[model samples]
Target: MLIAQISDIHIREDGQRCCGWVDTAPFLAKAVDKLNALRPSPSAVVVTGDLVDSGSPAEYARLHALLAPLAMPYYLVVGNHDRREPLRAAFPDHAHLRSGPFVQYTIDELPVRLVVLDTNIPGQHAGELCGERLDWLERRLAEQPNRPTAIFMHHPPFKTGNIPLDRLDLSGKERLAAIVSKFRNIHGVFCGHLHRAIQARFAGTIAMTCPSTAHQVHLSLGESSIMAFDMEPPACQLHWWDGHSLVTHTAFIERFDGPFSVQTGERIEIRTDSIHGRAP
Candidate 1:
C-alpha cells in the first residue's frame, strides 16, 4: 500500500502571490499532475496543512479548485496558517473534521492505522498539544495497542535545528514523547510546517516532514539565519507498506531526461535509448 503526503500548498486568492513573490499555484498544479501520473497511484493523499496562505474563504475556494483534479482520496489537517472554521466550512463532507472542535481523527481502512492530530493554536505560529488533545491521543493509541499506526500532525513535536523554525516548534513535547514511547505499535509520525523535508528519531519512532509543493524554506543552520524561501526542486513523499516494512521515498515534481538503465561489463557506458525498443 502506498500513501502520499502533500504539504504547504499555500494557495492564495486573486492575483496575490504567496509571500508577495512566488506564484505557488503552478507549483501545486505540477505536484497534482505528477501524483496522477504515477504508475500505481498512492492509496490515499494526506495533505498536512497550511492549505491556504491566510485561511480565507476565497483562498479555500481556490484551493478547492486546485485539488479537484487529484485522482486519489485526500485528507486534510489544520496548521498555524489555517483557520478551522473556514476549512470546515469549505469541506463539510469531511465528517471527522466536523465531529469536534479539533481536526483529529483516525482512518482504519488503510494498511496502517492513521491517527491525525490538531496542533494549531488559535493565534500563534508555535504549536501546543494541550491536556485535552493528549488525552484524546492516549485513548486512540490505547484502542489499537498492537496495530502499526502512524500519527499525522501539522507541527513536528521535535526541534528541526533551523533556529527560527525551532522557535515555532511544538510545545509540551516531553508529554507527547512519554505517550508515544508507551506504544510499541506506533510506527511513525508524519508532519509538515517548516516547508522542508526533515526526519529525526523521536520517542523510539521515526518522525518525518514532507517538503512543500510550493517554494522551500532556505536551509541555514546558523543562529542568525532567518526564515526565508528558495526556488528549489519541489516534491512529494510516497510511503509504501508491504505488511512487513514501511518505506518512504521522495518523488520530485520536475520531469528530467530519460530513466535509462545501464549494465556493467569490461567497460560500462551510459545508454540513453531503450535497447529492447530499438530494432536490432
Candidate 2:
C-alpha cells in the first residue's frame, strides 16, 4: 500500500505572497499535477496541516481550486493557523469537517490503520493532545490490538532540533508518548508545521514530517527572522507498507514531458559501475 503526504501549504487568498514573498498556490498546483502523473500512483494523499495561511473561507476556496487537478483521494487536518469554523463551512462535505470544533477521523480500509489526531489549540501557537483526544486514541488502539497503525497530526510530540520553533512543540507529550509506547502495533507518527521534513523518535516509533509546498524554513538554528521563505520546490513524502515494515521516500514536483520504464527487480553497485572495463 502506498500513501502520499503534503503539508504546510500556507495558501493565501489575497493573491499576495506569504510574508510578501512565497507564492503558495502555484507551487501547490504543480505538486498536485506531479502526484496525478505518477505511475502505479498512491492510493491516497494526506495534507497534514496548515492548508491555508489563515483558515478563511476565501483561502479554502483558493486551496480547493489549486488542488482540483489531483487524481487521488485527499484529506486535511487542522493546524494552529487554521480556523475550525471557516474550514468546516468551506468543506462541509468532508467527513472530518462537521458541526464540531474538532476534526478527527480514522481511515481503516488500508493495510495500516490510520488514526488522525486533533492537536490544534485555539488562539495559540503551541499544541496539546489532551484528555479527550488521548482517551479516543486509547479506545481506538484497543479495538485493533495487533494491526499496524500510523498516527497523523499537525504538531509533532517531540522537538525537531530547531530551538526557536521548538517553543511551539506539542504539550502533554509525555502523556501521548506513554500511550503510544503501550501500542506495539503502531508504526509511525506523521505531522507538519515546521515547514521542513524532520524525523524524531517518540515512544519507540518514528515521527516523520513532510516539507511544505510553499517555502522551506531556514536550517539555521539562530533566529534573526521569525519566519523565512525560500524558493524550495514543493515536495511530498511517499510511504509504502511492504507487508512487514514501512519505508518512506520524498519527491519534488517538476514539469517535463517523458515516457519512462522501471526495472525494479535488478540491483546495481555504484562502485562496481565506476571501475568497469568499458573503455575503447
Candidate 3:
C-alpha cells in the first residue's frame, strides 16, 4: 500500500502569489505530475493541512481545482491557517469531513488506518486537540489494537526546535504523547505547518513533518530564532507499506539534474585540474 503526503499548499483565491512571490499553483501542478509518474502510484494522497493561505471560500475552491488532476483519492486535515467551515463546505463529499464542526475522523479502508486529527484552533497560531478530540482518537485506537495506524495532522504534537514555529505548534503535547504511547498500533505520525521536512522519535513512533509543495521554512536550529522562508525545491512525502513495514521517502517537485550513472567493475579517475587547463 502506498500513500503520498503533500502539505502547506497555501493556495490563494485571487491567484495572487503567497508570501509575496511564490506562486503555489505551478508548484502544485508540478507536484501532481511527479505523483502521477511515480513507479507504483500511491493508493491515496493525504494533504496534511494549510490548504489555502487565507481561509476563504474562493481559496478552498481554487485548491479543489488545483488538485483535481491527482489520480487517487485524497484526504485532508486542518491547520491554523485553515477555517473549518470553509474547508468542510468546499469538500462536503469527502468521506471524513464531518457535519458537526471538527474534521477529525479515520480512514480505515486502506491497509493502514489513517487517523486524521483536527488540530486547528480557531483564530490561533497554535493547535489544540481538545479533550473531546483526544477521546475520539483513544476510542478509535482501541477499536483495532493490532492494526497499523498512521496519524495525519496539521500541527505536530512535539517540539520542532525552531523557536518561533514551536511556539505556535500543537498544545497539550504531554496528553497527546501519553495517548500515543499507549497505542502500539500507531506506526508513524505525519504532520505539516513547519513548512520544512523534519523527523523525530516520539512516543515510540517516527514523527515526520512534510515539506511544503509551495515553499520551505528556512532551516534554523536555534531554540530561539526568527522565521524565514526560501525557494528551496518544493517536495512531498511518500509512504510505502509492504504488508510488513512502512517506509517513507521524499519526492521532490522540481525535476533534479540528470540521473548520472557509474559503471561497475571499472576503475574511475578524477580528471579535473585546479583552475588551469594543464595539470600541476
Candidate 4:
C-alpha cells in the first residue's frame, strides 16, 4: 500500500494569500495533481494539519475545493491553525472527523494501521497531548498490539534542533515518549508542524516531519536563531508499505529539469506539463 502525506497547506480564501504573498491554494492544488498523477497511486493521502491560514469556515471551504481532485482517500489531522468545528462542518462526508470530541481516529483497512492523534491546542501556536488524548492513544495501541502501526499527528514529540521550532514543541512529550516506548508494533510516528522535513530516533521507533506544500520554515539551528519561512521547493511524502516494512520518498510538486540518462548523457523526455506553476 502506498500512502501520500502532505502538510501545512495553510490555504486561504480566494483572493487572499498566506503571509501576504504565498498563495497556498495553488500550491496545494499542484500537490493534489502530483499525487493524482503518481504511477503506483497511493491508497490514501494523509494531510497532517495547518489546513488553512486561519480557523475560518471560508478557508475550510476553499480547502475543501482544493482537495477535491485527490484520486484516493485522504485523511486530516488537527493542527494549531485548524478549528475542529469548522473543519468538521466543511467535510460532513468525512465521518471520521466527527467520530469523537477530537479529530482522532484509526484506519484499520490498510496493511499499516494508521492511528491519528489530535494535538492541537486552539488559539495557540504550540501543540499538546493531554492526559485524555494520551490515554485514548494508549488504549488504541493496546487493542492491536501485534498490528504494524504508524502514528500521525501535527506536532512532533521530539526536538528537531531548530531552536525556534523546538520552543513550540509538543507539550506532554515525556509522557508521550514513555507510552510510545512500550509499543513494539509502532513503525513510525509522522508529524508536520515544523514546515520542514526532519527525522529523529524516538522511543525505539522513527519519528519524522514532512515538509510543507507551500512555504517552509527556514533551517536555522542555534539557540538564538529566529523563526522565519522561505520559498523552498514544495513536496509531498510517499510512504510505501510492502507488507512488512515502510519506505518513504519525497516527491516534489513542481516540474523540474530533465531526468537525463546518466550513462549516455541523453535527455529523457518525460511529462512536465502537469505542474508548470512554481511555488511562490
Candidate 5:
C-alpha cells in the first residue's frame, strides 16, 4: 500500500541546468539512492510527469540511467515537457507507455488501482484531454466502479492560484470532473505541473501535486512568476492507506547540526551581562 510520488525531474541531455542554477540530475540520483535505502520500501514509485526538459531522446536516455538504481517498480505519465516517442522508446517494456497517439493506461493491483491519463497538448505549454484519451478514461472508470482508485496525470485538474501556472492547467476539466463524480471509489488525483506541493478537492476526491525532486517554485503569492531555484533540497511524498484513511508525508534529506531536544521553562541569557561582568 506504500506509494512514492516523484515529479518534475526536468532532465536535460545537453547538461544544461534548469534556470542556469540547479543541477537536476545529481539531485534526482540522490533521491533514488535515498529511496533505495528506506527500511520499509514503497510498493511502487510513480513519476507524475515532466520526465525530461525538452522531449529529447538523449534526455530520456539520461533519465533511464539516473532512475535505473531504484529498487522498486516504477511507472510514468506524459507531461508538457515529455515527447511521447522518446518516452516510449525509453520505457517500451512498461505497459502504459504508448507511442503513436497517447500514453495512458490503468495499473490495477492489490489494495489500489492507478488510472494513468495523458493530458499533454503537443506544441503548447498548456494541457488538454480530448478525443480518445477522455473516452478511454471514462471506459476505465466505468469498468472499475467500486475499486479503490487513484488517477494520475501530468497537468493538475485544479488551479494552483498562480495566474501563469493556472494558464497551463488541464482543459476540459469540467468533463473530466463529471466522469469522476460517477465513480465512488476514486481515492484521489495526483499530478505535476506547478513544481510545488498543492492540494485541492474535485468530484468528491482529493487532488494533489508533488514537488519536484530538483527545484521548487518560489512561494510568491501575488503576481505571475517562473522557475525560481533556491538552495532548498529536493523532496518527495510518501502515501499509504491505513485501512481506514489515506495519509501522506513529505520527506527531505539533509544533514543537520545536531539532534537537540527542547523542553518547557528553558532559560535565556543576555550577552551584555557577560560584558558587564568582565573586568574592563
Candidate 6:
C-alpha cells in the first residue's frame, strides 16, 4: 500500500497569501496535481495540518475547495495553526474528524493500520498530548498489539536541533515516549509543524517530520537562531508498505529537469519552462 503525506499547507483566504509572500493555494494545487499524476496512485493522503493560515471559517471554506480535487481518500490531522470546530464544519463528510472530543481516529481497512493523534493546543503555537489523549492512545494501541501500525500527529516528540522551533516542542513527550516504547508493533511516528523534513530515533522506532507544501522553516541550528522561513522546494512524502516493512520517499511538487535514459547514456530534450514561470 502506498500512502502520501503532505503537511503545513497554510492555505489562506481566496485573495490572500501566507506571510504576505507565499500564495499557498497555488502550491497546494500543484501538490494535488503531482499526487494525481503518480503512476501507481497512493491509496490515501494524510494531511498533517496547518491546513490554513488562520483557523477562520472563510479560510476553512477555501481550504475545502483547494483540497476537493484530490483523487483518492485523504485524512486530516490537527496542528497548532488549526481549529477543530471550524475544520469539522468545513468537511462534514469526513466523519473521522467528529469521532471524539479531539480529532483522533484510526483507519482499520488498510494493511497497515493508521492511528492519527490530535496534538493541537488552540490559541498557542505549541503542541501537547494531555492525559486524556495519551490514555486514549494507550487504549487504541492495546487493542491491536500485533498489528503493524503507524502514528501520525502534528508536533514531533523529539527536540529538533532547530532552536526556535524546539521551544514549542510537544509538552508531554516523555510520557509519550514511555508509552510508545512498549508497542513493538508500532512501525513509525510521523509528524509535521517543523515545515521541514526531519528524522530521529524515538522510543523503539523512527519518528519523521514531513516538509510543508509551501514555505519551509529555514535550517538554522543554534541557540541564538531566530525563527524564519524560506522558499525551499515544496514536497510531499510517500510511504510504501510492502507487507512487512515501510519505506519512505520525498517527492518534490514542482517540475524539474529530465529523467535521462541511463542505459543509453542519453538526455531527452524536454520543456525547460519553470512551473512558477520563473527564469531557469
Which candidate has the highest lDDT of all? Answer: 6
Q: Which ten residues in a row have the lowest lDDT in candidate 3?
A: 271-280
Identify the runs in model 6 with alpha carbons over 4 angstroms from their true place: 267-280
Give the deviation of candidate 3 from the true structure as CA RMSD.
Answer: 8.7
Give, for candidate 2, the lowest lDDT window spanning 10 residues.
Answer: 271-280
* Model 6 Cα lDDT, one tens digit per residue, 1-280: 7889999999998889899999999999999999998756788999998988789999999889988999999999999999999999999999999999999999998888999999999899999999999999999999999999999999999888889998997888899999999989998999999999999999999999999999999999878568889999999999888788788898899998778977886877545223312311
TM-scores, in order shown? 0.92, 0.87, 0.91, 0.94, 0.87, 0.94
Per-residue error (Å), model 1, residue 233: 0.8
lDDT of 1 at 254: 85
Question: For residue 184, what is the lDDT in candidate 3?
Answer: 78
Residue 272 alpha-carbon offset, candidate 6, angstroms: 24
* lDDT of the candidates, in the order given: 0.86, 0.80, 0.85, 0.90, 0.80, 0.91
Error of 6 at 85 (Å): 0.4
What is the Cα-based lDDT of residue 124 in candidate 3? 85
- lDDT for predicted candidate 1 compared with the true structure: 0.86
Q: Which pairs in model 3 have colliding backbones? A: none
Tell me the tens digit of each residue's lDDT in model 4 across 93-182: 999999888999999988889999999998999999999999999999999999999999999989877889888978888988999999
User: Which parts of model 4 have CA positions greater than 4 angstroms off?
Assistant: 269-280
Q: lDDT tens digits, residues 135-210, model 2?
A: 8888889999899888899998877667767878798789989999998998899998888788887898899888
Candidate 5 stretches with Cα past 4 Å from truth are 225-227, 255-280
Candidate 1 per-residue C-alpha lDDT over 1-280 given as tens digits, one digit per residue, 9 for 90 to 100: 7789999889898798999998888988999999887756677899998999998999998888888999988899899999999998888777888767788999998878999999999878899899888999999999999988889899998877789888897887789999999999877899999788899999989999999998898997869557898988888988777676568898888887655545433433444334322321
Candidate that beats the other on lDDT, 1 or 2, i.e. the better one: 1
RMSD per candidate (Å) reads: 5.3, 7.1, 8.7, 5.0, 10.3, 6.0
Candidates 1 and 6 compared: the better one by TM-score is: 6
